[model samples]
Every structure is written in C-alpha cells, then in structure tokens.
Target: MKTIAGILFIVLGILTAYQSKQAQPAAIDYAKERVQILQLIDTESKAFWDKDYEKWASCWAQEPYIRTMGWWKAGGVTVVKGWEERGPRTKQHMEQHPKPNPQNVRRENINIRILQDAAWVTFDQYGKDNGEPVMDMPGLSRETRFLEKHKGKWKIVYVGWLLEGEGN
Candidate 1:
C-alpha cells in the first residue's frame, strides 16, 4: 500500500508540472513580426515622400506621448512631441510642400529587437535621386524607430535620426 501511494504522488506531481507548462503562453513568431514591422516602416516612408498626409498619419500612434526628432549639421536639433503637435505640423507641411518628393533610398545595417508588444529598430539610410546621390538632402543618416503593437497592428511611437552631413 505504501509503495502504491508513493508512485501515485510522483505521477500526480508530474501531471501538475505538465499542466502548468501547457498553460504558459506560446512562443512569439519573430520572423512574422519582423516582416510586419518592416512593412509598416516602409509604408510610412512611402506615404511621407508621396505627401499623402492621411496615409502617413495612419502609421503613427495617435497617443499624446508620440514624438519625432532629428539632428543634422545644418538644422542642429529638432524635437516634435505629442501626436497632436506632430500630426497637425506634418499635415501643414505636406499641404505647403504638396509636390511629391519621391525618394530612392536604400536602408542598410538594419537591426530590430522586439519585446512582447514593443519593438526597437535602427538602420542606416542612403538617399538617391535620378541615379545619383541626393545633393540637397543628407546622403546618409542613422535612424531609429520605436513601435508598439496595439490591437494587433504596429504603430510608430517615436522616430529619431541623425544625418551624416550638412544639408544643402
């Protein structure tokens, strides 16, 4: 009787452990998530360059804490905080500069790290126009983007970049 009871206790312990493990969340599909993130980033850039304000706004979070900042040799530093401020300013800029400034930019040395609902991405970007390097804009820039997954979609929360050289 003692032997049977000891074996049953061990079996019960194993079953309990197995049940607990099964209840844990499944692993994240990082490859799929990375693709989704890259798509969103590309969409945002396209919308901006196309001067499509509505599409551009869709890529960003409408939260108050959202921000966009950049630093360049000519412009020094610029920080735009809050979606309310950023959104309106962007719309106005697009309206003022309605011409589509199409970009043939190459992004390289990209790195992305995802942590549950948040992600951080960094890349070096080179701009080109008419089969030649862009002269009026920064030729290369180091860019960083912060995104958050909300309601099963990723949205940009922060963007910061540093241009490699002065603007023309």
Candidate 2:
C-alpha cells in the first residue's frame, strides 16, 4: 500500500508539472518587437512633423477609444478623446500648418513593456528646433505611448505627453 501510494504521488506530480508548462504563455520576441515598435514611433513622429496628415493618421488605430493627452507648461493640460474628435481636428491642424516643422528630438531612457499584442512604452525626449535647443519645454519631456497589434500591424492607441516642470 505504501509503494502504491508513493507511485500515485509521483504520477500526480508529473502530470501537474506538464499541466503547468502547458498553461504558461509562450515566450515573446522582444528584440523583433522592439525594432518594429521603434520604427512605428519614428514613422508617426516624422509624419506629424512633416504635416502629412494621411501618413500620420495611418499610424493610429482609428478606434473610437484612442486618445491623446498633453500637459504643457504654458498651455496647462489638454485631452482629446475618440477618433471622431481627434481625426478631423488633426486634419485641420495639418491643413493649417502646411509648412514642415521638423523636430530634432532625441529619445532616452525608453522603457517598453510588451504583452502579447499590447505594448506600453515610456520615454524621455529632448528636442532642438533648428540649431538651437528647445527651451520652451526645456530638458527632457515625459512621453508615454500605448499600442496594439492588429492584423500583423502595430498602431498607436494612446499618446501622453508632459512637458518638463509640468504635471509634477
């Protein structure tokens, strides 16, 4: 009876181990995903600064729940929710500001957390306008971006920005 009980315990332990392994999520390819995410970020920024409304819009998810929030030292806080409100406003802005205001921004201290099809990213950005450093939002500004992958493409779902010395 003791031997039979011991064998049963071993079998149960083995089965439990197998079940646990099966229940675990698969490993993510962080390196590949990071590269893809960085590329998407770059595309979005370039399109925006270039005032290419269509291109910039393509980087977003186009979902009703998407949002953009900002806290600026001079302007205080602003929030734009839903694609219906954001899309037309952004398009109008792009039309009004036809000239390109290319930004020379350097992103640092980027931290990205990826979970399957969703990703959360945060970073510090330092910018220079033309040859002079941007003093209005001096130092590093805080930025956060949330993205979701759909149909094999990653699209921005939310963007948050807080200028230096603001939102503290």
lDDT per model vs. reference:
0.84, 0.84
Task: Count backbone overlaps in model 2.
Answer: 0
Stretches > 4 Å off in candidate 2: 1-26, 130-139, 165-168
User: Which of the numbered candidates is closest to the native, going by highest lDDT?
Assistant: 1
For model 2, state the Cα shift of residue 117 in Å: 0.5
lDDT of 1 by residue, 1-168 (tens): 999999999999999999999888777799999999999999998888788999999999999999988887666788999999999988987787777878867899999999778999999888654322222234788899999988989999999988884341
Among all candidates shown, the one with the greatest TM-score: 1
Q: TM-score of the candidate numbered 2?
A: 0.77
Candidate 1 Cα errors over 4 Å, as ranges: 1-23, 129-137, 166-168
Model 2 whole-model lDDT (C-alpha atoms) = 0.84
List the candidates' TM-scores in order. 0.79, 0.77
**Candidate 2 vs. truth: CA RMSD?**
6.2
**Model 2 Cα lDDT, one tens digit per residue, 108-164:** 999999988999999998754342222234456799999999897999999998887
